[model samples]
Target: MVFDAPPATASHSWMPSSPCGPACIEPIDEIGTARTLARLAGVIGLVLSFPVLTAATPKARREHMQRRYARTALRCLGLRLRIVDHRHEPVDGFAAPDTGVLVVAGHIGWADVLALAAVQPVGFVARADMVDWPVLGTLAKLTRVIPIERARLRELPGVVDRIARRLADGQRVAVFPEGTTWCGRAYGSLRPALFQAAIDTATPVQPVRLRYLDGDGNPCTVPAFVGTDTFGDSARRVLRSKGMTVEIVLEPRQWPGTDRRDLARRCADAVRGTDPSRHGLLDTEWIAAGSTRVQDPSVGERGPIRRTVMATRW
Candidate 1:
């Protein structure tokens, strides 16, 4: 099945764009055809059983099921998830019930939503058309994602208000502030619009750095759904790739001050780890204030955390 790309909005000139495309992708080792077919079957089975698994389950249990489903889905697609926590007090996988936090990340592709949910089941600010997609549409509804219409600029405030309400009620909500997807090798700037919700509710902003890596631990752009590529195109590429790892670096949380632009820029800087112009893998040092030891599960140990030089308003 083919999904048509959204038409370019003539009036929405601020929509983010990226120069990375299929050419930016590096060929990686692929699983055998039989294995690929088996993985595809696994994915189909999971998608078909999702509703039955989630149906009538309590909120906590449903979230547990969602996390398992997301991890299983990634495994079915031959992707491994590596989470790096840099927070002073590391909450279990981005879920904090007492208070709400706005999770922001560098947009990669459709799989990004799955990766975040795998860590902690959180509602997403997604494109309005995502609710109409095939099996994913059902998943979107189950998660109660907040849909945003890019073409309708006037409706943005309403979307922001909805997100603010969710945050105010102490519900974790994730959003890709870049406003568009980019190849894993490069990313776009974080638009300040969504940051308003965090500022409005005085919620801390969680900046997550997401990247795809090959078996050799180099950046991989095979999963990017950028340019004119359709969802099917990206999916086929991912299904064929082997030893693909989704590295999620949960950076320090920035408290929302009175400036959304500053918050957006600080979050972007944290995600990018350096100048946005630089390509290739970023050597991000997990920096945080205080003496709390940060843990790196990938390395299987805890280490001293360096103080972050980024100015914090609160």
Candidate 2:
């Protein structure tokens, strides 16, 4: 299968509900088993190379491999990633500063996480139940993954504290504040409450937008709502679905000084652009200016696909 790069143009036409061209899904059912083995291998690799990663003050070597692991895992799963422009680039012999970015990205398809992992060493906030999975659980721990108890709202403060602690340690924390995933055609409004930790820590919230394209680079199908779609099923659909290309554009970070609600609004506007309707569906309050609380359409729509798989930088 071939993948096409997104154009230089920023704007794109929203795809209609018609069936996308020829489905190019491949039979990647073997990826699940392959990925499990790869994750185990990566763990072994990390153990053997521990000395090299720690030889430097920042362990740049080890972190570099972690990014590579993320990308490779995604590629192995048949996911193609395309990072648009970076937020910052190295300058004057200095590397890009890690301000403990609180990365707030649009949650669309389950594959979206893979695309995000392809970029940097990120700390993912996942559901607590995912910890019991196979190799994915082990990898998440290695990546300093912070698991949250979605069923109990009271435990969230502690989870936020942990996330803040990681941020203080200079780790980029990624959260799907929409709290759920959907197709590219629709999105749950930004949940400003999820930003409480970043707000408290005064960390910059870096917003990112993701769009999936077909092998021809056209919008094929919106990768959305994985819980409703089992991983095995989703993987099969994706493999046979066609070579999907994901477009990820990172926006400027929103400083902590701004109101959390305003920050969320700005981010929603940034990701959604002028058309709130393009995303197949939007919360009623989401389209209203300055509303940060987004309505989640699938709060209780959990299914069997509860595991959080890791992806190397693709």
Candidate 3:
């Protein structure tokens, strides 16, 4: 179903506009009709089961089930999840941290949400309308997503305060600072407002780089849910795509300094890598090689150490 685009206002002036459209999506190998149908069936079953499974579960077990459900959802879409960690300390398994972390990433599509949750299930800062979306809406409520009304700019501070409270309570929260989606090929600048939450709580900001790649490790834009494309449009493209992989690169966590703008820039630099291009788009050649160097200038850090975690498919 086609979703109504939020009306533009002066408050949204800071939001970036992309030149990307349907033409940006590269042609890729696709699975057959039968396989695609089966994948769709699998996804439907999982979506239907999600609320029932988590309705009565405790917080800890519920989180575990959420991660499992997310990973399974990706698999059903014929996608593989590959995680590259650059942090000094990385933990295994799904465990809530003693302290909270602000997880930031470049927004690509709706699948970006599932991919992040699959790695480490965390609450999200999503568009308010998402809570009203059918089955997905129920799932959103179950995950406790923090909804922000883009049209109501005045409510942003309240949203920021809510994020800060979550962090203070030692809960990991994720936000796409760009405030919109981009094709995997290019991305917009990270907006500074949400970074204030991390600053207020003195929490570390985790910058994650997400990419959709084909089987041969080349960029794939088939999954991009941008422009006027409906949810069904994106879902069909993803389900039919073959050997599509979602690559998640975890950059070193940046400790919040006093300035939220500076912190946003640093986190943006980490997510965008050292690519010296407008909109921070990576060089196609570098992306295909499956490598990129992310350096945080504020911390005088050179680059992150590469650690790959190949998630086992269930």
Candidate 4:
């Protein structure tokens, strides 16, 4: 499960690039205090509902509640979400899904977790240190998110084992394989380490690209929780922005037996929005990430997102 010829930095790596794409903007538009209270109320409600949710006998009932709560919670935060599915095989919304599927999404800000939770009712793989955060930490523990000690290389396998078990049991597990956040302008490689978990469990890998757009339809710059960016600063940025739209572009799923390196490459390319023909990244580099911004999608009315490129087969 070595993800690269070299290796990735620790999970707590803090690299931030100021997005200079046409889609990025300045001037945070402050939100009213009432909206913030609404989100707080939503969080409180979730905390109160946990006992009943956990005690529910039916798994499907629990999942239904999770999705409902996530969506409502995002609304209270004044964020709108739109999901564009490009999967050849669409998943049944409320079906009791089989195990062995993993979601590898681009990491941008703390909101990535919240957004994905609303879109897909699945547990997440987060940093081990997050378990100490006040409210968020409690939610992650209650929701059964697997935590990885980013700096401890020896511990990755153990974390992956937990992920494998979750997948083997028919649950979808999400991971931010970038190992950290990036400028929304371009995507970095998917860490190869986690891909091993999928291969071992015979799990399918689904790639997703998450981006935040402002009221004017530009890349929302304020929400990125990157290097040295404090939680209060990021939260204020999101609250001050007039409108924040989270676009989730779901790519095709790579089935079991597909080479782990190949899976990492395609996912990296999709997240970067690179044309496959370009072969821009080396295989070694695909698993080991580096930061750089390559294009501006907002310059002109861009066409369909390459990540969500459609297919006729799974």
Candidate 5:
């Protein structure tokens, strides 16, 4: 199913002011056609394999198939995924190969879902409206996804509780605390309310950043699945193009120690440091946590992040 349009200011397709400028219209149209065919083929394949996956025990085969499906879909779109700075990335503290986890990450684009799924057997919290989408909705449910209504924030506790139970039983889950997708420049202040489970169980939170590089190696506007971005057009644009690199950057897991808000702040701070931008995306107050200045003898880099954002939240 095609996603809705992203917000106007956040649009990925920018029209040049000069009318005579080269048009990407033709390429976009062609890509859209290819995307349509791939989506149909994907749906058919999923239906055909359903019974076989259901019958398989231990499900390693089924899970690997899911990863393959995601990989194939991305490849058909001409999108390449690159992982960076993961050498020292720590494993999820409570994540057993068969168990579940609460993976809290930054939301930037639709690619994130596919990229994350390609790594492990996991689930996501999607909007209730997504359940109405044609093939995509059905496939999402098949992946053990749980849908939530955006209007009903009060039901969050019950929803998260259900997810926690799944995690306790060994199913990894991902949540975007920004509550929405955005350009990968900075992290939005996380909603403390959704972080209750970490506080309650001291569960580890995985912080990730998604960066989309253009053909020229510049940061491109990622296609968010929601908001005003046109899903069909965006899907076509991404699928047909080559030279784009989407990175699924996974960082070490953060353990619960302080207050809920403080934990959220630290997670956000750690994620912000990963931005390719020279200045970290964190607020000034956040940067003030330690000796904010130093005559650096080092080659090139901001002085160490001595102050901790977690301390300020209190």
Candidate 6:
């Protein structure tokens, strides 16, 4: 299978049905176990040497390999990533920066990290438990991912400090502001402290919303790593599904100085499909205010797809 770099234009003709009920569908079928395992094996074989190369190779070459590792892993897993940027700008590489860009995204599953890593190499805020994850944990440490000890609240400050230092050192860092995971429909607040780091450094905050879907366009729930779901189980679910595609929307990013709570709300609203650019207020706010639908700016009206997935209002 072949993978394409993000397209130059941002066009989401596949509009989703008004955000579905808060309940996310989780598919549990044993149909594609063999194929999934086969794909997993291929990815493992390709990445087994990552640790060795990371230490031995030069900085630029090492980062290149890491990205190739992610892209190759996604392809082997049969997940297609489609990125839509309203600005239509190309993805940026973390070559070096005075204060790196702070990237925030909605948390869906662990796979979400892999998909984003495929697009650009960003150091992420991971949980402490990941340190015990076999190959993955080791790789995360080698790649310089910042870990947070969720159990000890005091440790958070240290984690934040580390994240700030990472940013100061010119590394693009990705964080899931919800502070937790849930179905794709609903979202939690974007933690405020991290946003402050951007403010201190005068760096930009880019919000990228990610949703996994099927070729038919409906949201794909098979891969959600939610309650009672094991890593193995989620991997099998993804492998068994007909096929999976990821829709990544690069929202209009804002700089620091914006209220953290307000920024979080704006990010949530956009990720939830009520784009602030075209719509006046959040869709929910409008709905609660007694309006059924926030009138979309009369521009390009795309015909509905045959049971297709909805890309956020773009």
lDDT of every predicted structure (CA atoms): 0.77, 0.56, 0.75, 0.63, 0.55, 0.60
Give me the overall lDDT of model 1. Answer: 0.77
TM-score for each model: 0.84, 0.67, 0.83, 0.76, 0.70, 0.74
Estimate, for each residue in 1-314, the C-alpha lDDT of model 1 and write its tens digit. Answer: 22655322324444444444455566799888999899989988998898888886786677777888999999999999999998888588785665798999988888999999998989999988887766567788888999988767778899999999999999899999767676676565677888999999999988998988899998888988765677677777999999999999999999999989888889988988863443332235422211112222223232332222322221
Model 6 C-alpha lDDT per residue in residues 284-314, reported as the tens digit of each score = 3222211122222222342221232322211
lDDT string for model 5 (50-142, tens) is 546656745666766666676765665566777554426454322557655577777665667777765555788765655555445666767
In terms of lDDT, model 6 sits at 0.60
Clash count in backbone of candidate 2 = 21
- Residue 78: error of model 5 in Å? 2.1
Best by lDDT: 1
User: How far out, in Å, is residue 282 in model 1?
Assistant: 18
| Model 4 regions lying over 4 Å from their true place | 1-25, 52-58, 93-96, 256-258, 275-314
**In model 5, which regions exceed 4 Å deviation?**
1-58, 85-94, 274-314
Candidate 1 lDDT at 298 equals 26
lDDT of 6 at 143: 63
Task: Name model 3 segments beyond 4 Å from true.
Answer: 1-12, 56-58, 93-98, 276-314
lDDT by residue for model 2 (54-140), tens: 455365456566667667666654567887764564421111446577888876555665577777767798756444544344556
Alpha-carbon error at 47 in model 6, in Å? 3.1
Clashing pairs in 6: 15-310, 16-310, 217-308, 217-309
